[model samples]
Target: MGPAERSVLVAWSTFTTTFTATRAVTHWIRDGHGPASGGITVGGRHFHHYNIGIALLSAVGAVALRGQERHRRHPVTAMAYGAANALIVDELMLLLDLKDVYWAKDGRTSVDAAVGLIGVGGIYLAAAPFWHRAARELASTAVHRPA
Candidate 1:
């Protein structure tokens, strides 16, 4: 595969892994099965993962846009981008509503959003080669067939 395609595949893999791991860990914590206390806190404010995701995304995006090709296509950069995306998606509902609804019924939208993104990404990656082939085949048939 080309470098760009390889980078995308790496990113997609990272995104899926990060998303799944985040969900599992959060569930464990929420269920009170872990040793750690509640959410991360500095002073009196609770820090959310999405906040980190946004910062990482901004940094990564800037570097990718202005850095050298090698830097932009690096696996590390891809992983960071993927993980950032997952973190943001994991809290989509909260972002939409501007409130903490992580365990509420309204929070289900976050899961739905994550699933939708993962499915779309998976389909695109899996069908990448087929898409080009299908397009070529259709073009050839059109060229040879009567109008």
Candidate 2:
């Protein structure tokens, strides 16, 4: 409806898309449905998705904070931030324990957290308009009501 609303919608959509896509790709790789070797491995150390995620996030942050107006609202920056965040959060358990437990029982926490984040984001986006309206009404009433 307005610039703020449009921005929120675009941001939420981008984040959700990136998050879902990242999770799906991670699942595929974990299930051996992706690359033949699961993922890139070098020197007996397997590279995790979050590694690239962190890099992308850092790049996005750098660009966004470069004092360039055009770069701040760039779709690419938003997308990269969302995707990077998804990748990092998808491996929350691994990051915490410093071990691969993607298929282990505790790994479910990562999935839960990701899903919860998505759900909360969606709810906030959907309710933002109402929230704005309610805030305005409350302020108006407070100002107009008897003191």
Candidate 3:
């Protein structure tokens, strides 16, 4: 494939890896909690607030991609906003699952997690390389703009 397609693929893969990591942590914490407090306590990391950094990183990538795409400027912040919201949604899912409020009669809750991870993860993954390109473009434009 071409550069753009490759970039997109890389971004998608990065986001997928990020989501899977976050989900794994969430699942581990939910399963490990037995005292009704329901939180991760491994190697001194709570891991309860698990989505913040990844979401922020994705947002930055989103902005960078927007910068590359729109030399005229765009609401790249919206991408970040959406990612933040998705993070919250994932957190909610984790909480509900931990509370035992999420599950089918057949003990199926992983499906829900998988679906959200794919949907939300896809957003940031697509945004990452796009943002990186946008940021580069923006920098070039800025340098020329001053000249």
Q: Of models 1 and 3, which has the larger TM-score? A: 1
Candidate 3, position 71, lDDT = 25
For 17-104, candidate 2 gives per-residue lDDT tens digits of 8768876776677687855447778787788888988999899879867848777666666667777878888888999988888779
**Tens digits of per-residue lDDT for model 3 on 48-106?**
44357456656666666765655212333433443444354455545565654333342
Whole-structure CA lDDT of model 1? 0.89
- lDDT string for model 1 (1-147, tens) is 888889899989998999999899888877877665576777889888998889989989988789887899999899999999999999988999999998899999998988888899999999999998899999999999996
Which 10-residue window in model 2 sums to the lowest lDDT?
2-11
Query: TM-score rank, highest first?
Result: 1, 2, 3
- Against the true structure, what is each candidate's TM-score? 0.89, 0.85, 0.36
Quantify all predictions' global Cα lDDT against the true fold.
0.89, 0.79, 0.53
* Order of quality (lDDT): 1, 2, 3
The best candidate in terms of TM-score: 1
Residue pairs in collision within model 2: none
RMSD of 3: 12.0
What are the clash counts of all predictions, listed in order?
0, 0, 6
Best by lDDT: 1
